[model samples]
Target: MTTSTPSTPSTMRAIASYRGLPVDDPDSLQDIEVPVPQLRPRDVLVRVRAVSVNPVDAKVRSGLAPTDEPRILGFDAAGVVEAVGPEVTTLAAGDEVWYAGDITRPGTNAEFHAVDERIVARKPVSLNWAEAAAMPLTTITAWETLFDRFALTADSTGTLLALGAAGGVGSILIQLAMELTGVRVLASAGRPESQAWVRQLGADGVVDHHDLVASAGEVASDGVDFLFSPHSKGNIEAFARIVRPFGHITAIDEPEGLDLLPLKSKSIAWHWELMFTRTTYQTADMAEQGKLLETVAGLVDDKRIRTTLTKTLPDFSAAGLREAHRLVESGRTTGKVVVTR
Candidate 1:
């Protein structure tokens, strides 16, 4: 997303990609200039303080740029509100906020960004900018998956096997499930470091993801009640075997061309969640994101949940943004990487 016309009288520094090139390529990311966007009714313009890089940033950058204009690629950010649109009432200038902005809009990589107030919330008073920036996107993904899709509650009881349990979403998902519900949590991690990471985060049990059936079965002989896999491309068969009959499975990755026939026999229901869904679809419950974020902020301030910021890259330069993408693409990160202004 780019702006050809200045809605306001100013322009801002931003990192944008003119084309989808490899991360090692010099021109893959460039420091560029863009207009401070005109506010749509209900839009809140923010002075971005810090932004975090997720897998989506690398995935989007590897694809073709959407148009002739440079694409600004980022999702999660922490910032202060500079202005609000004509119809806005929930927030005003000088309010500190955090959000995973709409994927269809110009992203949070810029010095300034505009987002709908309905999906934005007040930042946690306890965290710094980098810490606040790292939580929104991954936290929202885990929150929506557990509450909105799976509908897990305090009274619910079952075993949840989390595949890819060391990544950003799983790191927080384990915390939320452990903190809020009585479910038995089994985390799948392949490496010693990743396993130790999840254990410290309070996973009830940790199993190696390789040979998930054998490993997870040792802990959950009756089969898991719920399965959450962040990487679901080639593991659907294993997912089918480990989950009990009538069990529920949810995934965030686009596991294109993977067969679901294995799941039909047991009547296992598979669901997909994109945290951006409500905002993009313009659903009546779109405002739920802001409310849930407020809840997560309360959790953070009270020290019940924590930010997953593992790495930090200073400044919003081409070098820093490129390294952030490289770390996300490497698939070796335990938590999230952030770039601070």
Candidate 2:
């Protein structure tokens, strides 16, 4: 329980949830007034400047049951800190920050939102509100998978395959692996434009996603050392084949009927990363997320890496937010879609 409500408004405008309607329905996402969230001991109130629409936003909105509560839907955000809770130490009012918020909490689709300081970090100085907003969720997933789960080092050498390389997470994963590690990534993108997009992001090679194993084989004859599987449902067996014996795979998608039997025989280790894991369970090392973000921020400022923002809506208008959602739902979008202030 923390005090300090004077600078905060009693209510804020936000985009409300779909009540289980399809994206085409104009009523699916609408403008609504919701009370500003209260802060916890370690919470910081962010005056959200921009938010990016992720696939989960569409999935959650479409699956959401009818509710009297306004379920705001967004995760990635970049904004200024308006207020801090009593126990907040790392951030303060007026400090700009960015974070992909916890899925368990009411989201960042609002004008104001509250998040734990441990998971929030200084916004990259090089990127604007929209560009900065485009990262966070994907960046966290990529950073955690490559550095934390796989324990990759700068001296590490091997061929890494990024399946679905044009999507948000894959887009960043390609850049991070190329910039931070000795391993070269063969980015898998089905479309020519997508292949070009990933290559522009510093990918060492690009493979067609339609024939993942065959395309990847052309690049890594002995199979790859690491596979970044953003969508692993129907491709588990293919992944096991592409990965060398005792190789590693990192997955972010939740696919039904997932079978990992193929990997068991090859001793391929599977690592799953969810950016919300830290904030949802309040892990002891949660602040490590902030530190990593800070590190990436430096890389961004140094121009060694870049933001994946490709589409931008001018403002927080409901129509714009819905359009962003529709674009993401279309499944053809490359990089990230952000609605900015």
Candidate 1 ranges with C-alpha deviation above 4 Å: 1-9
Each prediction's total of clashing residue pairs, residues at least 3 apart in sequence or on different chains, is: 0, 0
Q: Return the TM-score for each candidate structure.
A: 0.96, 0.97
Cα lDDT, all candidates:
0.90, 0.90
Candidate 1: RMSD to truth? 3.0
lDDT of 2 by residue, 236-317 (tens): 8888888999999988888887889989988999988888888889888999888888889999999998999999999697
Judge candidate 2 at residue 198 and give its lDDT: 94
Q: Please, what are the lDDT tens digits per residue for candidate 1 over residues 1-341? A: 22222333488999998888999987888899988778898899899999999998898898955467988889899998888888888998889999999988889999899999999999999999999999999999999888877899998899998889899999999999999988999999999999999999899999899778899888888899999988888888888889999999999988679788999999999999899899888999988999988999999999999889988888688889999999989888998899999
Residue 229 miss distance in model 1 (angstroms): 1.2
On a 0 to 100 scale, what is the lDDT of residue 183 in model 2?
Answer: 93
